[model samples]
Target: MFKKIKYGKIEVRSQTLVLFSAIYFAFILNLAFWRYILGHVQINNFANFFFIISTAISVVSAFYIFFNLIIVPFAAKPLLSLLLLFSSIVNYMMFSLNVFVDKDMMRNVFETTTAEAWDLVTIPGVIWVLVLGILPAVFLIRIKIKYLSFKKELFSRIKLIAIAIILLLIQVPFFYKSYASFVRNHSEIGHLLNTSNYIDGTIKEIKTRLNSNHKFIRLDENPSLVLNDDGAKTVFILMIGETARDANFSLGGYKRNTNPFLRKEDVIYFKDVKSCGTSTAYSVPCMFSNLTRSGFSQSKARYMENVLDLIKRAGYDVIWQENDEGCKHVCDRVTIENMLERKNSPYCRTGYCLDEVFLEGLDKKLMNIKKDTVIIMHTMGSHGPAYYKRYPDRFKIFKPTCDTSDIQNCSRESVINTYDNTIVYTDYIISSVINTLKKFPNLESGLLYVSDHGESLGEKNLYLHGMPYAIAPEEQKTVPMILWMSDNMKALDYINYSCLKSKAKDNDYSHDVIFHSLLSILEVKTISYNPDLDIFRSCRTRRFPY
Candidate 1:
């Protein structure tokens, strides 16, 4: 009754404890991968929670495996590992998130509503789930095939002590790994908060940040150059947009003549403009901040001066008009954005609003201001899944539309046509703004149009944008930028139109150049202005200054 066992009829004793430990270890590995996917990567607590679940699972599993492995012969699969494998898979599913996955909501999870639209138009978390999922089951099945055996006397009560020790030892590593990951994760969040200030100052030095701190800075005895023209009567509107591709625009030279009305206006179209980012969350913040595309990746956005604050300081009236529903506050410090963004209505939709809504009060708002005013008209141009949602009902130019929110149900061609239709509408919207600006007899009005980021339209079977910037496709990088000057502004010596025209078609332009170009056009000067970095300085070449 002390120690007697047979290993598949081989006379040597079977070390069932080691085999049980290996199977248990494999299951823990499987579950650990799942925990990472569900965005539930707590430290020891998560591991411990799963371990407790595994223990409960093992209770039922022990009985099943014992009968299946010993009493009932030829099961081919290991009982312990099978429980471990299946349980681990279920746990992974529990941790799955929709943020990193594409359309995973069709699975009908308990956690359907997300803080993000289309979980914020980002990739769903299921990509990792599938890759890490099936291997555990396969490995566990193989382990059972290779390790099934019987130990006759060692199944006694006193031997239970050794079995308990074996389970605990194998379980410790998984618990420790989870603990380490959690510690690292929390520290990263802490770092993001800490670095926000340092980054803000550096970006402000270049005049590319939102200028949230500019008010506090202006309070200083020696302040930066201020945007307040002190009643010179100037206005500026910065249209912070989202996920708009250059190809969709009629003004940007799309074959569809999407910007049909824009062509008749006096706008300088920078046909070869490129975007710094592919996603709105990443790009919009970066564009407003002074950080370069290369610098944005290695650092956090918290410490930069967004462009709006600089505009405020240079003495221009600043306003943020937003149509993008999911847009974040990159210009928060400079001016509070007036919500052109629509609330829920029959025509009002989720994730974004129509370009028409943005135009609704623009003319009225323009007359109210006497300062050299600036207005940012944020557009919901071509932000997808429901690309047709960005435009009004009348803009549905393409016949046989796929105007529903469920993107997959619609054909790819239908989805693209609907998206391009929104581009067509965007073309009209920009032209209308140009016309409104022309009404001021004494005003030297100009408009600088830039997209927050570009989008992907069915390239390599990829539906949208935001493939890490390093691998972002051309459709997501090439943006269409145009600067329109009223005849009054150019003819009256407010700007050198011929010089701007020379550089408009150059391929080396980027959002980086906008920081300096805006200041050049507006006539603002700061101590930190680098002639080489500023777009209008004589030292800068015909190409890009940034």
Candidate 2:
């Protein structure tokens, strides 16, 4: 039996019922945080349980006090219930995926293609939402909460607020070291807190996108390139790869021959190359901009006219062919084509296309090319969690591969086999592009393949990518970079093929090199070019040699 309290104009509900209800909701909702803290922190004795319990109580009491203010005045019980349900759903998905709800994840939600989004839907995810979110929400809406008068409600809120403050204070001494360490080492833990996570992500995304959308200052003026007197036409192809890790490629000394085709194509593979960021959204724009990893920011990258623009300004014809998402505004000022939109292409499947699809009209596209030209191809190489869908069935050489979108549900070996098959397919695509380049014998040509970023494949219990760059694992930062030049292009004394080959195996490179390397190779002269960041700078022993 619950005791009812008297109030000014309204009948007071059972005080015991209200108190227990708040406690129950708080305890259940904060379960994930408690588990995370318990697993991470060492337990010396029963005092550890006290700290953990106090932490959960503090969170719950805080929520209770805040909800009391709104629920009494605005009849916001349904609103609070809805918020809890929404947060529960978000938390459930994150728990199932072993992911944190952060700004980058929010960006992915916003920018993902239809096919990619469909890949995220699974029976397990649905069950998680139903068990954690919908079930609780249904019970919450069904609960009967009696209203007290304004005066009595206000008094009750004050009492609860006092209790919450006291409970929070109790945590100070017991959890000081743990709290400080967690805040220092795992600062992003704040982004995992329910409701706050999505709120923070939304705010940051809005502010960052607004800043990026503003007009940017131009980097170069009157940029130009003077060709050698030999009058050889230059054709530079930049292959922008996606979600490709160096560790998985045979060319990078991996045990598997994932890059069998590229390995035999006489390509110069650059080992130890790191990315500017850990996501395509960050890395694509950063790699094209005249900014080093230290100087990079999404806002700045969005505003600046990148290496391609400067190359175009220097009188070289530039075009971008994309099978992946749009170029992150990198090709805004250049000629650009998307393969997915092209009709009658057998390579297009379920609203997405493979990397090779972009090469269909290549010969016709290059028939009237300029003396100096640069073609950039952006690939959808090995994008997950549907790695099996990235390539054709014929390329599924690795048997027992994970064919489902739920990569985590599959065995580790199957997931890896699926991923490796995608790599092998990518190798084939790159080799095909090389063979296409060989068709035009009259022009001096070169191809440089650089991934936007690397991927995580069940390493440290992490899968996929979009991790923060500073704390990202080596798999997410180290990417494959391969280069190839036609015999005619390699013959130039100043081009220095030997020098490039000599350092290709040992030199350390990053996305920072991309901007300047393109400029240097294209013979573009500009004030913004930094020779130090150019990978070819050491190789160019005779810049003036004709």
Candidate 3:
């Protein structure tokens, strides 16, 4: 049985080598896939054996199905070995991180900069890749093969395929109901299969991005605006908040006073607002683009300028102050100040600048603009698992906070406490921005605070954001939005001040409103602007203020 047998150019040591290799590879390499199915599918006493046999058959049959479809006929032994080794590496990463590979994660991989890549490098990651990927790859590359005739090789391959199909066919009648139910109930299990997840995701990402580039229809070649500007210079500030969920916001009626400062102010809090996507990489650009959430296309968004660009075209000086990684290319043509690069600033510590750092020289930046201006402050708000690092020591009001970046290691209570503290700190930051804007009373100033997306706090064993939007929990989609305009700013004739009071919490809104609302408020007239999607539409008496 230990003897080597040859079939064409391929060599197998006994037929047992082929059978054992197929079973071993399926079971070992797909541990994550198996674990997911086992946890999700119900197993009654009588159905237990049925599920087990069905799963085993599915794995073995899938292996042969793909092998005969691709590897057997097309790939030589060496190439097939390389592909297997590469897949093992991907499996190790996914299993260790508890991440599901989907289009968004693939987008993240392609969009990841060098600085962001460091977060993924860890001791466990290194260990898993070495044990699961490199060792297997070395063995495969070093192995030798014996040869046989082409006819014999084809016969052997067909025989193996036939056997796998027969076994799968036999299981269908006995366990068809259980198998169908499991697959239907836990559809995501297919994405966890080794190599298939990333392969499918990558292909999608590439196709979407490629098609997305040429789809942009310019909003306005030369935008014209009618300012409700009285004697004061119109100043509009947009705060792009990060990873903040409405469930944690005190303004949204959360149990905690996470937004104590903002609550004290006249913030028109929008209660029912959902994000376009679950990741910053997707949400940032989407929110700023002049496209409705329902009508939005990633392919089209990448090509056009956003609300900021339209505001600039309307003759306002646009400045972007970034404390996060970036404004996701929305600020490319605008004047940008990198707050995180201000290493000498007090807000800079531990290779990251606190959200307050975004305000360091805001007053001076404002002074340079003689014309009406729009300033965007993109903050690193409540981004975890380093929740403790987000706020200053004094703002660590939530006691026994989770200090470690590894959130799962901490108790769920501690995670919530720490995360809430970050929200409180964010409140202070927003209030501070409002206070600073107040100092320039002569300027017609207003601040609109909206988060790119929301976060999940260990709900149902899910620790973070970026679950596919279609199936994501409400906690990951619902975000907090606040608008505060100075009395002078609200006096803009086109803005119906009554609407802000009436629609503060009653209506359902989304990132769809951001684009149209900004254009309406700024009084930028363009063909792309749709009043129907604007939250302020009912309040506006006219498109332009005389």
Give the whole-model CA lDDT for all candidates, comma-separated.
0.54, 0.78, 0.77
Candidate number achieving the greatest TM-score relative to the actual structure: 2
- Kindly report which residue pairs in candidate 2 clash with one another: none
Best by the lDDT measure: 2
Task: Evaluate residue 267 in candidate 3 and report its C-alpha lDDT on the 0 to 100 scale.
Answer: 80
Over 1-546, each residue of candidate 3 has an lDDT whose tens digit, in order, gives 333335423343423435554665677777877777777765777587677867877787866656554444234455556656767766765564455778887887777655445544555656766776667566544443332466886787788788888888887778877767766866666678876787798999898976665755667898777753456688889998889999999889999888889888888889979999988888999999876677676667778888888888888889898877677778988999888678788888755788988677778765655788898888889876567878889998987888866666678899999999999989999998898888887788899999988988978677778777877889889999999888777765456666876786679999989998888777777777887877777776664433
Model 2 RMSD to the real structure?
3.8
Kindly list the per-residue Cα lDDT of model 2 for residues 281-308, writing each as its tens digit. 8899999988788998877877888999
RMSD of each: 13.9, 3.8, 4.0
lDDT of 1 by residue, 471-531 (tens): 5677788787777776654543245666666767654677777665666556555543435
Q: Candidates ranked by TM-score, best first?
A: 2, 3, 1
TM-score of each: 0.60, 0.90, 0.87
How does candidate 3 fare on TM-score?
0.87
Better of 1 and 2 by lDDT: 2
